[model samples]
Target: MHKYQKLNIQKLYQIYIYLTIRLLMNVMWIVLAIFLIILIFERVAERLGIDRWYKLSSIGWIFLSIYWLSSFIAYLDTDDFVNMLLTLLAAIFSFIIAFKIIIDNRKYPWKNITLWVTISILIIFPFYKIPILRDFLIDMVANHTLFILSSVFNASGEIITDATIILNGFPVSIVIGCTAIESMAFFAGLILCLNAPLKRKIIALVFIPVIYIANLFRNAFAIYAYGNQLFQFGIIGTAHESFFWAHNVIAKIYSFLVVVILAYLTFKIFPEFLTLIEDIISSFKKDVDK
Candidate 1:
Protein backbone atom coordinates (compact mmCIF):
# COMPACT_ATOMS: atom_id res chain seq x y z
CA MET A 1 0.00 0.00 0.00
CA HIS A 2 1.10 3.57 -0.72
CA LYS A 3 2.23 5.88 2.13
CA TYR A 4 -0.59 8.31 1.46
CA GLN A 5 -3.17 5.50 1.54
CA LYS A 6 -1.80 4.28 4.87
CA LEU A 7 -1.99 7.81 6.30
CA ASN A 8 -5.56 8.18 5.08
CA ILE A 9 -6.63 4.94 6.71
CA GLN A 10 -4.99 5.91 9.97
CA LYS A 11 -6.65 9.31 9.87
CA LEU A 12 -10.04 7.75 9.19
CA TYR A 13 -9.62 5.43 12.15
CA GLN A 14 -8.55 8.32 14.39
CA ILE A 15 -11.58 10.33 13.30
CA TYR A 16 -13.94 7.48 14.03
CA ILE A 17 -12.55 7.15 17.53
CA TYR A 18 -12.57 10.91 18.07
CA LEU A 19 -16.18 11.29 16.96
CA THR A 20 -17.35 8.53 19.27
CA ILE A 21 -15.67 10.12 22.24
CA ARG A 22 -16.75 13.61 21.24
CA LEU A 23 -20.42 12.65 21.23
CA LEU A 24 -20.23 11.70 24.91
CA MET A 25 -18.03 14.63 25.90
CA ASN A 26 -20.16 17.17 24.07
CA VAL A 27 -23.15 16.24 26.22
CA MET A 28 -21.06 16.50 29.35
CA TRP A 29 -19.79 19.93 28.40
CA ILE A 30 -23.30 21.17 27.70
CA VAL A 31 -24.59 19.82 31.02
CA LEU A 32 -21.68 21.24 32.98
CA ALA A 33 -22.03 24.71 31.41
CA ILE A 34 -25.74 24.69 32.20
CA PHE A 35 -25.17 23.73 35.82
CA LEU A 36 -22.46 26.34 36.29
CA ILE A 37 -24.63 29.03 34.70
CA ILE A 38 -27.54 28.20 36.97
CA LEU A 39 -25.28 28.28 40.02
CA ILE A 40 -23.84 31.61 38.96
CA PHE A 41 -27.28 33.07 38.44
CA GLU A 42 -28.41 31.99 41.91
CA ARG A 43 -25.25 33.35 43.53
CA VAL A 44 -25.49 36.67 41.67
CA ALA A 45 -29.13 37.09 42.60
CA GLU A 46 -28.48 36.28 46.25
CA ARG A 47 -25.55 38.65 46.68
CA LEU A 48 -26.20 41.97 44.95
CA GLY A 49 -23.11 43.33 43.26
CA ILE A 50 -22.97 44.70 39.73
CA ASP A 51 -26.54 43.90 38.82
CA ARG A 52 -25.85 44.88 35.24
CA TRP A 53 -23.12 42.28 34.88
CA TYR A 54 -25.44 39.62 36.19
CA LYS A 55 -28.18 40.71 33.81
CA LEU A 56 -25.86 40.60 30.85
CA SER A 57 -24.50 37.22 31.88
CA SER A 58 -28.03 35.95 32.36
CA ILE A 59 -29.02 37.08 28.88
CA GLY A 60 -25.93 35.45 27.44
CA TRP A 61 -26.54 32.17 29.25
CA ILE A 62 -30.21 32.03 28.32
CA PHE A 63 -29.52 32.54 24.67
CA LEU A 64 -26.70 30.02 24.76
CA SER A 65 -28.95 27.45 26.38
CA ILE A 66 -31.63 28.05 23.79
CA TYR A 67 -29.10 27.78 20.99
CA TRP A 68 -27.84 24.44 22.27
CA LEU A 69 -31.36 23.15 22.75
CA SER A 70 -32.50 24.33 19.36
CA SER A 71 -29.50 22.74 17.68
CA PHE A 72 -30.17 19.42 19.39
CA ILE A 73 -33.85 19.61 18.52
CA ALA A 74 -32.96 20.48 14.99
CA TYR A 75 -30.94 17.30 14.71
CA LEU A 76 -33.83 15.16 15.94
CA ASP A 77 -36.67 16.84 14.07
CA THR A 78 -35.78 15.55 10.58
CA ASP A 79 -39.40 15.42 9.43
CA ASP A 80 -39.92 19.17 9.08
CA PHE A 81 -38.62 20.90 5.94
CA VAL A 82 -36.69 23.64 7.76
CA ASN A 83 -35.29 21.19 10.23
CA MET A 84 -34.16 18.79 7.51
CA LEU A 85 -32.57 21.57 5.51
CA LEU A 86 -30.73 22.89 8.54
CA THR A 87 -29.62 19.40 9.49
CA LEU A 88 -28.34 18.69 5.98
CA LEU A 89 -26.43 21.95 5.88
CA ALA A 90 -24.97 21.30 9.31
CA ALA A 91 -23.96 17.79 8.32
CA ILE A 92 -22.28 18.91 5.13
CA PHE A 93 -20.29 21.66 6.82
CA SER A 94 -19.37 19.48 9.76
CA PHE A 95 -18.18 16.67 7.49
CA ILE A 96 -16.17 19.07 5.35
CA ILE A 97 -14.41 20.54 8.36
CA ALA A 98 -13.83 17.15 9.92
CA PHE A 99 -12.36 15.81 6.72
CA LYS A 100 -10.19 18.86 6.29
CA ILE A 101 -8.89 18.61 9.83
CA ILE A 102 -8.02 14.94 9.37
CA ILE A 103 -6.22 15.55 6.10
CA ASP A 104 -4.41 18.73 7.14
CA ASN A 105 -2.96 17.46 10.42
CA ARG A 106 -3.61 20.84 12.04
CA LYS A 107 -1.85 21.72 15.29
CA TYR A 108 -4.95 23.17 16.89
CA PRO A 109 -8.13 21.16 16.46
CA TRP A 110 -10.33 24.21 16.84
CA LYS A 111 -8.83 26.22 14.00
CA ASN A 112 -11.93 26.00 11.79
CA ILE A 113 -13.89 27.98 14.41
CA THR A 114 -13.39 31.21 12.48
CA LEU A 115 -14.96 29.67 9.38
CA TRP A 116 -18.01 28.50 11.36
CA VAL A 117 -18.33 31.90 12.98
CA THR A 118 -18.25 33.64 9.60
CA ILE A 119 -20.92 31.30 8.29
CA SER A 120 -23.14 32.00 11.31
CA ILE A 121 -22.68 35.78 11.00
CA LEU A 122 -23.57 35.66 7.28
CA ILE A 123 -26.71 33.65 8.08
CA ILE A 124 -27.78 35.98 10.89
CA PHE A 125 -26.84 39.45 9.59
CA PRO A 126 -29.22 39.30 6.61
CA PHE A 127 -32.10 38.18 8.82
CA TYR A 128 -31.26 40.98 11.21
CA LYS A 129 -31.53 43.59 8.39
CA ILE A 130 -34.53 42.15 6.53
CA PRO A 131 -37.87 43.69 7.50
CA ILE A 132 -39.66 40.69 9.02
CA LEU A 133 -36.62 39.09 10.68
CA ARG A 134 -35.39 42.52 11.71
CA ASP A 135 -38.68 43.26 13.46
CA PHE A 136 -38.70 39.96 15.34
CA LEU A 137 -35.13 39.67 16.68
CA ILE A 138 -34.71 43.44 16.96
CA ASP A 139 -37.86 43.82 19.01
CA MET A 140 -36.85 41.00 21.36
CA VAL A 141 -33.24 42.13 21.68
CA ALA A 142 -34.12 45.81 21.98
CA ASN A 143 -36.75 45.22 24.65
CA HIS A 144 -34.40 43.06 26.70
CA THR A 145 -31.42 45.34 26.12
CA LEU A 146 -33.47 48.48 26.79
CA PHE A 147 -34.75 47.02 30.03
CA ILE A 148 -31.17 46.28 31.06
CA LEU A 149 -29.87 49.70 29.91
CA SER A 150 -32.72 51.54 31.63
CA SER A 151 -32.20 49.69 34.88
CA VAL A 152 -28.46 50.42 34.70
CA PHE A 153 -28.51 54.09 33.51
CA ASN A 154 -32.01 55.10 34.59
CA ALA A 155 -32.72 56.48 31.11
CA SER A 156 -35.85 56.34 29.01
CA GLY A 157 -34.64 53.67 26.62
CA GLU A 158 -36.56 53.26 23.41
CA ILE A 159 -35.33 51.79 20.15
CA ILE A 160 -35.84 54.24 17.29
CA THR A 161 -34.16 52.62 14.28
CA ASP A 162 -32.89 49.06 13.83
CA ALA A 163 -30.27 49.60 16.51
CA THR A 164 -30.58 53.20 17.66
CA ILE A 165 -31.44 53.81 21.31
CA ILE A 166 -33.20 57.10 22.08
CA LEU A 167 -33.00 58.72 25.47
CA ASN A 168 -35.99 60.93 26.24
CA GLY A 169 -34.02 64.12 27.01
CA PHE A 170 -30.67 63.47 25.35
CA PRO A 171 -30.06 65.16 21.98
CA VAL A 172 -27.77 62.41 20.66
CA SER A 173 -29.07 58.85 20.81
CA ILE A 174 -27.08 55.78 21.80
CA VAL A 175 -27.11 52.70 19.59
CA ILE A 176 -27.66 49.44 21.43
CA GLY A 177 -28.88 45.89 20.73
CA CYS A 178 -28.05 45.96 17.04
CA THR A 179 -26.99 43.24 14.61
CA ALA A 180 -23.47 44.57 15.07
CA ILE A 181 -23.53 43.51 18.70
CA GLU A 182 -24.96 40.13 17.78
CA SER A 183 -22.36 39.70 15.05
CA MET A 184 -19.48 40.53 17.39
CA ALA A 185 -20.80 38.44 20.22
CA PHE A 186 -21.30 35.48 17.91
CA PHE A 187 -17.80 35.70 16.47
CA ALA A 188 -16.22 36.36 19.87
CA GLY A 189 -18.13 33.55 21.52
CA LEU A 190 -17.15 31.21 18.71
CA ILE A 191 -13.48 32.09 19.11
CA LEU A 192 -13.68 31.64 22.84
CA CYS A 193 -15.56 28.37 22.44
CA LEU A 194 -12.92 27.16 20.00
CA ASN A 195 -10.33 27.74 22.73
CA ALA A 196 -8.84 30.87 21.16
CA PRO A 197 -6.94 33.38 23.31
CA LEU A 198 -8.82 35.63 25.75
CA LYS A 199 -7.38 38.80 24.22
CA ARG A 200 -8.97 38.00 20.88
CA LYS A 201 -12.29 37.34 22.63
CA ILE A 202 -12.05 40.65 24.48
CA ILE A 203 -11.06 42.41 21.27
CA ALA A 204 -14.03 40.89 19.51
CA LEU A 205 -16.40 41.95 22.31
CA VAL A 206 -15.04 45.51 22.53
CA PHE A 207 -15.01 46.05 18.77
CA ILE A 208 -18.62 44.97 18.34
CA PRO A 209 -19.96 48.01 20.13
CA VAL A 210 -17.29 50.19 18.59
CA ILE A 211 -18.67 49.28 15.16
CA TYR A 212 -22.19 50.13 16.28
CA ILE A 213 -21.16 53.49 17.78
CA ALA A 214 -19.01 54.40 14.78
CA ASN A 215 -21.95 53.65 12.47
CA LEU A 216 -24.19 55.83 14.64
CA PHE A 217 -21.77 58.76 14.39
CA ARG A 218 -21.37 58.12 10.68
CA ASN A 219 -25.12 58.48 10.28
CA ALA A 220 -25.12 61.72 12.24
CA PHE A 221 -22.26 63.06 10.11
CA ALA A 222 -24.05 62.03 6.92
CA ILE A 223 -26.99 64.18 7.97
CA TYR A 224 -24.67 67.20 7.83
CA ALA A 225 -23.19 65.98 4.55
CA TYR A 226 -26.68 65.70 3.05
CA GLY A 227 -27.71 69.18 4.23
CA ASN A 228 -24.49 70.83 2.99
CA GLN A 229 -24.43 68.97 -0.35
CA LEU A 230 -28.09 69.41 -1.22
CA PHE A 231 -30.07 72.11 0.63
CA GLN A 232 -27.25 74.61 1.34
CA PHE A 233 -25.66 74.60 -2.13
CA GLY A 234 -27.31 73.59 -5.38
CA ILE A 235 -30.53 71.57 -5.56
CA ILE A 236 -29.27 68.85 -7.87
CA GLY A 237 -31.73 65.94 -7.57
CA THR A 238 -29.46 63.36 -9.25
CA ALA A 239 -26.38 64.28 -7.20
CA HIS A 240 -28.35 63.57 -4.03
CA GLU A 241 -27.88 59.83 -4.66
CA SER A 242 -24.27 60.34 -3.62
CA PHE A 243 -25.46 61.46 -0.19
CA PHE A 244 -27.87 58.52 0.06
CA TRP A 245 -25.23 55.95 -0.93
CA ALA A 246 -22.76 57.48 1.49
CA HIS A 247 -25.33 57.38 4.27
CA ASN A 248 -26.42 53.81 3.56
CA VAL A 249 -23.83 51.35 2.25
CA ILE A 250 -20.50 53.16 2.57
CA ALA A 251 -20.97 54.13 6.20
CA LYS A 252 -22.05 50.63 7.24
CA ILE A 253 -19.10 48.93 5.51
CA TYR A 254 -16.64 51.47 6.94
CA SER A 255 -17.95 50.83 10.45
CA PHE A 256 -17.44 47.10 9.95
CA LEU A 257 -13.89 47.79 8.78
CA VAL A 258 -13.38 49.85 11.95
CA VAL A 259 -14.32 46.76 13.96
CA VAL A 260 -11.69 44.76 12.05
CA ILE A 261 -9.17 47.48 12.80
CA LEU A 262 -10.07 47.49 16.48
CA ALA A 263 -9.62 43.73 16.66
CA TYR A 264 -6.15 44.11 15.14
CA LEU A 265 -5.35 46.95 17.56
CA THR A 266 -6.39 44.90 20.60
CA PHE A 267 -3.88 42.22 19.69
CA LYS A 268 -1.12 44.79 19.15
CA ILE A 269 -1.78 47.06 22.14
CA PHE A 270 -2.86 44.44 24.67
CA PRO A 271 -0.64 41.55 23.75
CA GLU A 272 -0.53 40.28 27.36
CA PHE A 273 -4.23 39.46 27.09
CA LEU A 274 -3.12 36.56 24.93
CA THR A 275 -1.29 35.01 27.86
CA LEU A 276 -4.50 34.84 29.85
CA ILE A 277 -6.30 33.42 26.85
CA GLU A 278 -3.56 30.85 26.31
CA ASP A 279 -3.90 29.79 29.93
CA ILE A 280 -7.57 29.03 29.25
CA ILE A 281 -6.61 27.14 26.13
CA SER A 282 -4.02 25.15 28.07
CA SER A 283 -6.57 24.15 30.66
CA PHE A 284 -8.91 22.80 28.01
CA LYS A 285 -6.03 21.18 26.19
CA LYS A 286 -5.10 19.35 29.35
CA ASP A 287 -8.62 18.00 29.66
CA VAL A 288 -8.79 16.90 26.02
CA ASP A 289 -5.38 15.30 26.23
CA LYS A 290 -6.36 13.37 29.34
Candidate 2:
Protein backbone atom coordinates (compact mmCIF):
# COMPACT_ATOMS: atom_id res chain seq x y z
CA MET A 1 0.00 0.00 0.00
CA HIS A 2 1.03 3.66 -0.59
CA LYS A 3 0.70 6.78 1.54
CA TYR A 4 -1.45 9.87 0.86
CA GLN A 5 0.09 13.26 1.45
CA LYS A 6 -0.95 16.82 0.69
CA LEU A 7 0.95 18.93 -1.84
CA ASN A 8 1.46 22.58 -2.75
CA ILE A 9 -0.75 24.44 -5.25
CA GLN A 10 1.81 24.05 -8.05
CA LYS A 11 1.88 20.26 -7.66
CA LEU A 12 -1.89 20.17 -7.06
CA TYR A 13 -2.45 22.00 -10.30
CA GLN A 14 -0.86 19.25 -12.43
CA ILE A 15 -2.74 16.54 -10.54
CA TYR A 16 -6.06 18.31 -11.07
CA ILE A 17 -5.53 18.49 -14.84
CA TYR A 18 -5.67 14.72 -15.32
CA LEU A 19 -7.93 14.05 -12.30
CA THR A 20 -10.69 16.09 -13.95
CA ILE A 21 -9.37 15.59 -17.46
CA ARG A 22 -12.67 14.29 -18.81
CA LEU A 23 -14.58 17.26 -17.45
CA LEU A 24 -11.89 19.62 -18.75
CA MET A 25 -12.24 18.20 -22.24
CA ASN A 26 -16.06 18.36 -22.12
CA VAL A 27 -15.97 22.02 -21.12
CA MET A 28 -13.42 22.69 -23.84
CA TRP A 29 -15.69 21.36 -26.56
CA ILE A 30 -18.74 23.11 -25.09
CA VAL A 31 -16.85 26.39 -25.15
CA LEU A 32 -15.81 25.68 -28.72
CA ALA A 33 -19.43 25.12 -29.72
CA ILE A 34 -20.43 28.39 -28.13
CA PHE A 35 -17.66 30.18 -29.98
CA LEU A 36 -18.65 28.55 -33.25
CA ILE A 37 -22.18 29.82 -32.83
CA ILE A 38 -20.83 33.28 -32.08
CA LEU A 39 -18.61 33.25 -35.15
CA ILE A 40 -21.50 32.11 -37.37
CA PHE A 41 -23.66 34.93 -36.05
CA GLU A 42 -20.81 37.39 -36.44
CA ARG A 43 -20.36 36.42 -40.09
CA VAL A 44 -24.05 36.84 -40.77
CA ALA A 45 -24.05 40.22 -39.00
CA GLU A 46 -21.05 41.35 -41.04
CA ARG A 47 -22.84 40.46 -44.27
CA LEU A 48 -25.92 42.41 -43.10
CA GLY A 49 -23.80 45.41 -41.90
CA ILE A 50 -24.77 45.05 -38.23
CA ASP A 51 -22.42 46.04 -35.38
CA ARG A 52 -23.81 44.32 -32.29
CA TRP A 53 -23.66 40.73 -33.58
CA TYR A 54 -20.24 41.23 -35.17
CA LYS A 55 -18.89 42.74 -31.95
CA LEU A 56 -19.60 39.45 -30.19
CA SER A 57 -16.65 37.96 -32.10
CA SER A 58 -14.31 39.32 -29.44
CA ILE A 59 -15.74 36.74 -27.04
CA GLY A 60 -15.28 34.02 -29.68
CA TRP A 61 -11.59 34.84 -29.95
CA ILE A 62 -11.22 34.70 -26.17
CA PHE A 63 -12.94 31.31 -26.22
CA LEU A 64 -10.30 30.16 -28.69
CA SER A 65 -7.59 31.34 -26.32
CA ILE A 66 -9.15 29.41 -23.47
CA TYR A 67 -9.55 26.36 -25.68
CA TRP A 68 -5.87 26.16 -26.52
CA LEU A 69 -4.81 27.00 -22.97
CA SER A 70 -6.77 24.01 -21.69
CA SER A 71 -5.24 21.85 -24.40
CA PHE A 72 -1.78 23.03 -23.30
CA ILE A 73 -2.45 22.11 -19.69
CA ALA A 74 -3.86 18.71 -20.70
CA TYR A 75 -0.69 17.91 -22.63
CA LEU A 76 1.54 18.98 -19.74
CA ASP A 77 1.10 15.63 -17.98
CA THR A 78 2.32 13.80 -21.05
CA ASP A 79 5.88 13.50 -22.44
CA ASP A 80 5.06 15.02 -25.81
CA PHE A 81 7.14 18.17 -25.68
CA VAL A 82 6.48 19.07 -29.30
CA ASN A 83 2.72 18.96 -28.82
CA MET A 84 2.99 20.85 -25.51
CA LEU A 85 5.10 23.63 -27.05
CA LEU A 86 2.87 23.99 -30.09
CA THR A 87 -0.27 24.17 -27.93
CA LEU A 88 1.43 26.72 -25.68
CA LEU A 89 2.21 28.91 -28.68
CA ALA A 90 -1.32 28.43 -30.00
CA ALA A 91 -2.72 29.54 -26.63
CA ILE A 92 -0.52 32.64 -26.56
CA PHE A 93 -1.31 33.58 -30.15
CA SER A 94 -5.04 33.10 -29.57
CA PHE A 95 -4.82 35.23 -26.42
CA ILE A 96 -3.11 38.00 -28.33
CA ILE A 97 -5.60 37.68 -31.21
CA ALA A 98 -8.52 38.02 -28.80
CA PHE A 99 -7.14 41.29 -27.45
CA LYS A 100 -6.44 42.56 -30.97
CA ILE A 101 -9.99 41.77 -31.97
CA ILE A 102 -11.28 43.60 -28.90
CA ILE A 103 -9.26 46.81 -29.50
CA ASP A 104 -9.99 46.93 -33.18
CA ASN A 105 -10.02 50.70 -33.63
CA ARG A 106 -8.61 50.11 -37.12
CA LYS A 107 -10.59 46.87 -37.63
CA TYR A 108 -8.83 43.65 -38.70
CA PRO A 109 -10.08 40.39 -40.12
CA TRP A 110 -9.06 38.41 -37.07
CA LYS A 111 -12.66 37.30 -36.72
CA ASN A 112 -12.29 35.27 -39.90
CA ILE A 113 -9.42 33.45 -38.19
CA THR A 114 -11.69 32.69 -35.26
CA LEU A 115 -14.16 31.07 -37.63
CA TRP A 116 -11.37 29.02 -39.18
CA VAL A 117 -10.19 27.80 -35.78
CA THR A 118 -13.75 27.04 -34.82
CA ILE A 119 -14.32 24.91 -37.89
CA SER A 120 -11.06 23.04 -37.43
CA ILE A 121 -11.85 22.36 -33.78
CA LEU A 122 -15.43 21.42 -34.59
CA ILE A 123 -14.15 18.74 -36.99
CA ILE A 124 -11.23 17.45 -34.87
CA PHE A 125 -12.85 17.49 -31.45
CA PRO A 126 -16.08 15.76 -32.48
CA PHE A 127 -14.35 13.12 -34.55
CA TYR A 128 -12.12 12.43 -31.55
CA LYS A 129 -14.96 12.10 -29.04
CA ILE A 130 -17.86 10.49 -30.93
CA PRO A 131 -17.25 6.74 -30.85
CA ILE A 132 -19.32 5.63 -33.83
CA LEU A 133 -17.94 8.23 -36.23
CA ARG A 134 -14.42 7.85 -34.92
CA ASP A 135 -14.51 4.06 -35.13
CA PHE A 136 -15.85 4.14 -38.68
CA LEU A 137 -12.99 6.33 -39.84
CA ILE A 138 -10.44 4.21 -38.01
CA ASP A 139 -11.92 1.04 -39.43
CA MET A 140 -12.00 2.41 -42.95
CA VAL A 141 -8.37 3.36 -42.81
CA ALA A 142 -7.25 0.14 -41.13
CA ASN A 143 -9.15 -2.17 -43.47
CA HIS A 144 -8.00 -0.34 -46.57
CA THR A 145 -4.46 -0.35 -45.29
CA LEU A 146 -4.54 -4.10 -44.63
CA PHE A 147 -5.86 -4.61 -48.16
CA ILE A 148 -3.03 -2.50 -49.55
CA LEU A 149 -0.44 -4.45 -47.64
CA SER A 150 -1.74 -7.83 -48.75
CA SER A 151 -2.74 -6.99 -52.35
CA VAL A 152 -0.62 -4.04 -53.40
CA PHE A 153 2.59 -4.90 -51.63
CA ASN A 154 1.99 -8.68 -51.70
CA ALA A 155 2.68 -8.74 -47.93
CA SER A 156 0.94 -11.07 -45.54
CA GLY A 157 -1.46 -9.06 -43.40
CA GLU A 158 -4.81 -9.44 -41.66
CA ILE A 159 -7.36 -7.24 -39.91
CA ILE A 160 -7.68 -8.59 -36.39
CA THR A 161 -10.35 -5.99 -35.61
CA ASP A 162 -11.75 -2.72 -36.86
CA ALA A 163 -8.75 -0.77 -35.65
CA THR A 164 -5.95 -3.34 -35.62
CA ILE A 165 -4.07 -4.54 -38.67
CA ILE A 166 -1.62 -7.36 -38.29
CA LEU A 167 1.20 -7.75 -40.78
CA ASN A 168 3.03 -11.00 -40.23
CA GLY A 169 3.25 -11.29 -36.42
CA PHE A 170 3.32 -7.52 -35.65
CA PRO A 171 0.22 -5.38 -35.17
CA VAL A 172 -0.54 -1.80 -36.11
CA SER A 173 -3.39 0.11 -34.45
CA ILE A 174 -5.25 2.63 -36.54
CA VAL A 175 -6.64 5.73 -34.88
CA ILE A 176 -8.88 8.45 -36.26
CA GLY A 177 -5.88 10.67 -36.94
CA CYS A 178 -4.55 7.99 -39.27
CA THR A 179 -7.50 8.66 -41.61
CA ALA A 180 -6.03 12.09 -42.56
CA ILE A 181 -9.18 13.74 -41.23
CA GLU A 182 -7.27 16.44 -39.39
CA SER A 183 -5.49 17.45 -42.57
CA MET A 184 -8.72 17.34 -44.49
CA ALA A 185 -10.51 19.38 -41.84
CA PHE A 186 -7.78 22.03 -41.78
CA PHE A 187 -7.88 22.38 -45.55
CA ALA A 188 -11.66 22.41 -45.49
CA GLY A 189 -11.62 25.29 -43.04
CA LEU A 190 -8.85 26.91 -45.05
CA ILE A 191 -10.85 26.80 -48.24
CA LEU A 192 -14.13 27.83 -46.63
CA CYS A 193 -12.93 30.44 -44.11
CA LEU A 194 -10.64 32.41 -46.41
CA ASN A 195 -11.63 34.98 -49.00
CA ALA A 196 -11.60 32.84 -52.11
CA PRO A 197 -13.76 32.53 -55.19
CA LEU A 198 -16.50 29.91 -55.12
CA LYS A 199 -15.08 28.22 -58.21
CA ARG A 200 -11.57 28.05 -56.73
CA LYS A 201 -12.79 26.76 -53.38
CA ILE A 202 -14.52 23.86 -55.10
CA ILE A 203 -11.35 22.97 -56.94
CA ALA A 204 -9.32 23.12 -53.72
CA LEU A 205 -11.86 20.94 -51.94
CA VAL A 206 -11.00 18.10 -54.32
CA PHE A 207 -7.72 17.63 -52.47
CA ILE A 208 -9.45 16.42 -49.31
CA PRO A 209 -10.18 12.97 -50.79
CA VAL A 210 -6.90 13.07 -52.65
CA ILE A 211 -5.14 13.47 -49.30
CA TYR A 212 -7.08 10.54 -47.91
CA ILE A 213 -6.08 8.27 -50.80
CA ALA A 214 -2.49 9.38 -50.52
CA ASN A 215 -2.63 8.73 -46.76
CA LEU A 216 -3.80 5.16 -47.37
CA PHE A 217 -0.63 4.46 -49.29
CA ARG A 218 1.41 6.26 -46.64
CA ASN A 219 -0.16 4.13 -43.91
CA ALA A 220 0.45 1.01 -45.95
CA PHE A 221 4.13 1.84 -46.27
CA ALA A 222 4.41 2.60 -42.56
CA ILE A 223 2.72 -0.63 -41.54
CA TYR A 224 4.84 -2.63 -43.97
CA ALA A 225 8.06 -1.16 -42.65
CA TYR A 226 7.18 -1.34 -38.98
CA GLY A 227 5.29 -4.63 -38.95
CA ASN A 228 7.84 -6.45 -41.07
CA GLN A 229 10.61 -5.12 -38.84
CA LEU A 230 12.51 -3.95 -41.89
CA PHE A 231 14.96 -1.78 -39.97
CA GLN A 232 16.06 -4.34 -37.38
CA PHE A 233 19.67 -3.37 -37.59
CA GLY A 234 22.38 -1.41 -35.81
CA ILE A 235 21.23 2.10 -34.70
CA ILE A 236 17.64 1.40 -35.89
CA GLY A 237 17.37 -1.46 -33.41
CA THR A 238 13.80 -2.60 -32.66
CA ALA A 239 10.14 -2.11 -33.56
CA HIS A 240 10.21 1.34 -32.03
CA GLU A 241 13.17 2.36 -34.21
CA SER A 242 11.47 1.03 -37.32
CA PHE A 243 8.31 2.97 -36.43
CA PHE A 244 10.26 6.17 -35.80
CA TRP A 245 12.18 5.97 -39.05
CA ALA A 246 9.23 4.95 -41.21
CA HIS A 247 6.29 6.73 -39.60
CA ASN A 248 7.90 9.71 -37.90
CA VAL A 249 10.82 10.57 -40.15
CA ILE A 250 9.96 9.35 -43.64
CA ALA A 251 6.15 9.44 -43.54
CA LYS A 252 6.09 12.81 -41.79
CA ILE A 253 8.44 14.42 -44.32
CA TYR A 254 6.40 13.14 -47.25
CA SER A 255 3.11 14.14 -45.61
CA PHE A 256 4.50 17.62 -45.02
CA LEU A 257 5.69 17.84 -48.61
CA VAL A 258 2.29 16.72 -49.84
CA VAL A 259 0.60 19.50 -47.84
CA VAL A 260 3.13 22.04 -49.11
CA ILE A 261 2.49 21.03 -52.70
CA LEU A 262 -1.25 21.25 -52.14
CA ALA A 263 -0.82 24.68 -50.55
CA TYR A 264 1.19 25.83 -53.55
CA LEU A 265 -1.52 24.43 -55.79
CA THR A 266 -4.05 26.53 -53.85
CA PHE A 267 -1.81 29.54 -54.36
CA LYS A 268 -1.88 28.92 -58.09
CA ILE A 269 -5.62 28.29 -58.19
CA PHE A 270 -6.67 31.17 -55.94
CA PRO A 271 -3.89 33.73 -56.20
CA GLU A 272 -5.63 36.48 -54.22
CA PHE A 273 -6.20 34.07 -51.31
CA LEU A 274 -2.45 34.14 -50.83
CA THR A 275 -2.75 37.83 -50.28
CA LEU A 276 -5.39 37.15 -47.61
CA ILE A 277 -2.99 34.85 -45.76
CA GLU A 278 -0.22 37.44 -46.09
CA ASP A 279 -2.46 40.07 -44.56
CA ILE A 280 -3.35 37.72 -41.67
CA ILE A 281 0.35 37.28 -40.86
CA SER A 282 1.37 40.90 -41.42
CA SER A 283 -1.50 42.16 -39.27
CA PHE A 284 0.13 40.63 -36.22
CA LYS A 285 3.63 41.58 -37.36
CA LYS A 286 2.57 45.19 -37.82
CA ASP A 287 1.21 45.28 -34.29
CA VAL A 288 4.36 43.66 -32.89
CA ASP A 289 6.53 46.25 -34.62
CA LYS A 290 4.45 49.09 -33.26
Q: Give the top-scoring candidate (TM-score).
A: 2
Question: Which window of ten consecutive residues has the lowest lDDT sum in model 1?
Answer: 52-61
Write the residue-wise lDDT of candidate 1 on 22-68 in tens digits: 75445424433433453346456547663333222223223334444
Off-target runs (Cα >4 Å) in candidate 2 are 1-23, 43-59, 66-85, 233-237
Cα lDDT of all candidates, in order?
A: 0.48, 0.76
Assess every candidate by TM-score: 0.35, 0.79
Give the alpha carbon lDDT tens digit for every residue of 158-276 in model 2: 88865888777778888876899888888888788877778878878898998998899899998999887777666845567776677766887788799899989878887666877
* Model 2 score (lDDT): 0.76
Task: Return the lDDT, model 2, position 40.
Answer: 58
For each candidate, how many residue pairs have backbone atoms clashing (under 3 Å)?
Answer: 1, 0
